[model samples]
Target: MTWNILVGGQDRLDAIASVIRREQPDVLALQELKGWSARRARDFAGQVGMHAHLAPSVFGQPVAVLSRRAPARTRSITWRLHHAAAVATVGGLTVVSTHLNPFDPERRRREATWLSACFFRTRQKVLIAGDLNSLDPGTDHSEAVKRIAPRYQRRHLRPDGSVDTRAIQAMAAAGFVDVGRGIGPTVPTEGLRQDEFGDFRLDYLMASPPLAKLARYVSVRRDEVTDMASDHYPVVASFG
Candidate 1:
């Protein structure tokens, strides 16, 4: 599972815990963990019945991975990224939780390439999930997209002024399959940042070919609990 949790869920930990308890995912990747400290993370993990592995902060906001079992190994990617990518090896699978630069596509493009070189191309059993904040080539143009400010929209435009999808396009070219591809939109739950993005599928769970093949299903959470928890919805993937 992966979710942005909207600026640390605006202090709504109980609602967040409620959703996680109901879903019972083996592992959950979380982004936008603003104002979180090691002690807070440990306490939250205890509340959710999981073990946490954290990343270094970018302006006090980091990313994290919570799993049912302890990680065998862990690492972080902080260079050239908005929020550090939290990595953990648990149950023999390498899990990467990341949140890319939401305001810059060129940087996102570079981040995507760098991430591919480091992880996707290795043919390892890996799961990369989080708020990519980059649109795919074939997704629909929603009504919400038109509401964004022209300046912010300009950031996502290609040189020719079309919507630039190069970031995610680069990842697919580097050999990762978007495991959450056909799943519904994962953003704009409630109280979303109006100037940022449309109601699109910005969050993702990209898996290596082998791991993707083993994935049985994927789901996006909606409804009362999710809306109460964050501005973006939670996405879950299952492999047997």
Candidate 2:
């Protein structure tokens, strides 16, 4: 019942394909994708001998799900605040991949509400994962990640920051635990102008409390999976 999740920040299709090949996950979730990216995912899945479904969250932006087994309930949930939520049911679990709005708190809150509602209505266990665009629960910030910070704070309180923690709190209240927080930092980028690892963890793998018991492993792929994969690393969580 384990699955692999990939968020498409600025990832290369080839690298993404490599991860799928290496992990051999039952399911893969990709975010921040364009129409081309979707095609690439399908192509890569073909190469790896798997199946892929590209579900666009927004008009131009998309989220994709690749599976070894056909999905039972795979669909896209539209939202006003951010891109959209891509959901699929596998092994009796409802898996959702989302990236929230960064520019506006009101929008994020609205999106969060919509997402919570969707989670509430689902009968299957929930597993939520993606780059939520929030401050890492721990870490100091470089001016870059701080300058273009999301409007909302993260649910975990800190000394000083203009983050909107409301959305995270809302999700938690509905029973989703931040996987990045519990497992450890998932993002580990390094460079002169692009070193955000010293900062807190923003990537995540949230899940309903009940699903926590089913989790056998939770981790982020820190290795350089590819030369042009993405600026943000991929977070992977597996359940049994």
Candidate 3:
């Protein structure tokens, strides 16, 4: 019943593969995926002895799920904002891997509402994890991301990358609790690069209160395998 989840940006099959080998996560959720190749995703799942559910469509590229056990049911659906959700199962638990819109707050909020409805309707245990391209604690930009000058920093937020507190709030309101607080920032990819720690906990793993009780550990890092692959750190959450 224990599992690991990885969330990051694209072109990271190698890094992801490495994590799959090392963590042996019973379930994995990835953002920024491409291709219609079931072989590639299935190959990775095969390497880890898991089955994968993939959607190579829209924003942040795509979203995927690799589970050690095949889900009882699987479905893919897209919200108005290009955000996608992969609903799967591990025993009696229902898991959804999703990444919300990054720039447009309204779209993100709208999508959150849709997601909330799904949660209310599901009767099984649940877990939701992904990039969300979101930030908590405030609606303003990081001083560093801001100080880079609007011209340079704007690249940091693009095509709907805006702070949506309501999105986070909605998840909370839906009874999902973030496992990132006090654990440290899971962003900026690298931990030793800047003054102090420039990481912010943007990526997340949330579960229903009952499911949270099953979580054994939640760790954030941009270590060797993850750092070399992408610009965002991987958030790994384990639940039994």
Candidate 4:
């Protein structure tokens, strides 16, 4: 499962933890964990009976992964990258949790390029899931974006007048299938009052072929617990 809990909202961590407990996901990819230190993440994981790996956040919004099993290897990848990302190898699968820059598509492309290259280098099955911030241009969400934030339409469009799909495309070219495809909008339109983007599929769970085959199903959780938990809904993917 992947979720972007609001930054510095430790007061709401219990609400987020409630949802996590109910879902009981094998692994959790969390982003926008601002003010969360390694010790805090570890303590949260321990409370939930999971092992955690937290990436140091240069922008105060760290990414982290919590798993039922201990990871064979874990680290933070932020060298030459716009935002920090957390990586962990658990049960032969490489899981990455990240949050991309919302204001710059060019920077997002660079981050995606680096991520794709790293995904290719890893021999194990891989799953990259988080708040990408870039939407698939081919998919139509312009009306929604305009409705929520008319100003963002101009900023979100590329210099060539195209929507920023480079990040997702890069991952696709690297052989990752966006499991979030066909799934309903991951962000709630009602939450647009808090954030700029409208009901778009900004969060995703992209998996390599091997990992994709293992995935039994994928969905965006929108229960009462999730609806009030955060601006972005949690995306859950079950594997066999």
Per-model lDDT: 0.82, 0.59, 0.64, 0.81
TM-score of each prediction? 0.94, 0.76, 0.80, 0.93
Q: Total clashes, candidate 1?
A: 0
Tens-digit lDDT string for candidate 4 (1-240): 999987744677888888888889889999988888899999999888889999987654789999999999998986655568999999888999988877788888888878888875434589998988878745876567666665677546678766668888888888888876888777762432354767688898988887787888998888767777788888999987
Candidate 4: clashing pairs of residues: none
Steric clash count of candidate 4? 0
Identify the candidate with maximal lDDT. 1
Model 1, span 1-240: residue lDDT tens? 898887876668788888899999889999998887767777898898999987867543689999999999989777778788999999769999999878778888898888877887455688889988888877755344556777778656777767777888888999898888778778777644355666678898888887988999998988877876887899988897
Root-mean-square deviation of every model = 1.8, 4.6, 4.7, 1.8
Which residue runs of candidate 1 sit more than 4 Å off their true CA positions? Answer: 140-144, 191-195
Clashing pairs in 3: 102-160, 102-161, 102-162, 103-160, 103-161, 103-162, 104-160
lDDT of 2 at 92: 76
For model 3, what is the alpha-carbon lDDT of residue 216?
81
lDDT of 2 by residue, 130-225 (tens): 656555423444443454334322333234554445666677777676655655544444321233233445666677776766777777666656
Ranking by TM-score: 1, 4, 3, 2
Give the range where candidate 4 is weakest over 10 consecutive residues by summed lDDT. 188-197
lDDT of 1 at 81: 84
